[model samples]
Target: MNEQLVLRVLGMDCAACEQRLAYAVRRVEGVRYAVADHGTGVLEVHLMPGTDREAVAARVVEAGFTVTGVETR
Candidate 1:
């Protein structure tokens, strides 16, 4: 029951911003992997079953960015 979460992140201006956000997202519980692209302002995350989406978004925000939107698939 793993899931993929696609998030549109704001305020990402460079590769460093992407890396920081990706690292933060990966630290959240149940996150299997995360990748953030500065060019697209998107973060794609692979999460384990039952991962809390809000918590993930919060983590992204805490990492110094904004989560504009989220989609689960």
Candidate 2:
């Protein structure tokens, strides 16, 4: 089964920002889905086994967002 990573990403206050962050995150290896909600500043990423959470967080930063919190399940 895939792992789900819930992240609190800042600066995604608009649809564009949300889309940009999702795009960047989806480019990361092992990510199956990257969904961001600007209203909630939440980014939910479902990834394959062995996917690196840090790498996904890095991509969020690269996309000009800040990850303030993270939880995995």
Candidate 3:
């Protein structure tokens, strides 16, 4: 089964921010897909096996965004 990570990210004020953050998240090794909505401040990622959720979150932080909450399913 696949895993999904839902995060509440902060400081994304525009579409460009969404693109930038989405790009960064997509670069993480086990990420299959990623989308960020600045309007909702929500970032959703589909991850494959061997993916570390924390690592994904770290990538988000490294991209100049703040991750305030996280959920998995």
Candidate 4:
């Protein structure tokens, strides 16, 4: 089983910030893939089933970004 999570991230002001956040999300245990877009402020993540959304949010926070919203697709 797998889940797709698209998060709208705020406070990313540069390409480095986007890359860092994408890298952080990928570092999460259940995340299979991640793409952080600075222009759109969105992070699309493909994750394993039973993954904790809070954990995902925490990883983004650890990278100094804020998750404003989450959407499933």
Candidate 5:
């Protein structure tokens, strides 16, 4: 039941931004892994079953970035 969450994030300007966001997202309770790519403005996350998507988005926002879109599969 694991889910893959694809997020479009804004305001990331460099590799440091990607690393910072990946760290923040991976700390969320249900996240298995997170990879942020500033070049494409995308954050890909693997989450445990039943993880709340809103909660994940909140964590990203808290990390000082904007989550412009979210796709779950």
Candidate 6:
């Protein structure tokens, strides 16, 4: 099974921040796909089954973005 996660991000000031976050998420194992939008401060990620959402979020934070909220679908 696959799961989708969307995170509402904060403190992203420009496109570069968006790019960095996207890259970090993509680096996680089992991350099938990912996209980060600076305008919306949202990141949509598709993951394989059992993917750790918090770990993914941590990577985002480590990349220098604050995760304000998260939704899994």
Among the numbered candidates, top TM-score falls to 2
For model 6, how does the per-residue alpha-carbon lDDT over 1-73 read when each residue is reduced to its tens digit?
8899999999777888878888889999999999998899999999999988888999988887789999999
Against the hidden true structure, what lDDT does model 6 obtain? 0.91
Clashing pairs in 3: none
For candidate 2, the lDDT comes to: 0.94
The model with the greater TM-score, 1 or 2, is: 2
Looking at candidate 3, the ten consecutive residues that score lowest on lDDT are 49-58
| Alpha-carbon local distance difference test for all models | 0.93, 0.94, 0.95, 0.90, 0.94, 0.91
Q: How many residue pairs clash in each candidate?
A: 0, 0, 0, 0, 0, 0
Q: Which RMSD values do the candidates have, in order?
A: 0.7, 0.5, 0.7, 1.0, 0.8, 0.9
Worst 10 residues of 2 by lDDT: 9-18
In model 1, where is the ten-residue run with the lowest total lDDT?
60-69
Q: Stretches of candidate 1 above 4 Å error?
A: none
Q: Model 5 clash tally?
A: 0
With a 3 Å backbone cut-off (N, CA, C), the pairs that clash in candidate 4 are none
Model 6 / residue 42 / CA error / Å: 0.1
- Residue 65 deviation, candidate 5, in Å? 0.4
Model 3 lDDT on a 0 to 1 scale: 0.95
Candidate 2, which segments miss by more than 4 Å at Cα?
none
User: How many backbone overlaps does candidate 4 show?
Assistant: 0
Q: Model 3 Cα displacement at 49 (Å)?
A: 1.8
Q: TM-score, each model?
A: 0.96, 0.97, 0.96, 0.91, 0.95, 0.92
On a 0 to 100 scale, what is the lDDT of residue 36 in model 6? Answer: 90
Local lDDT at 14 for model 3: 98
lDDT of 1 by residue, 1-73 (tens): 7899999999999999988999999999999999999999999999999989899999988998988899988
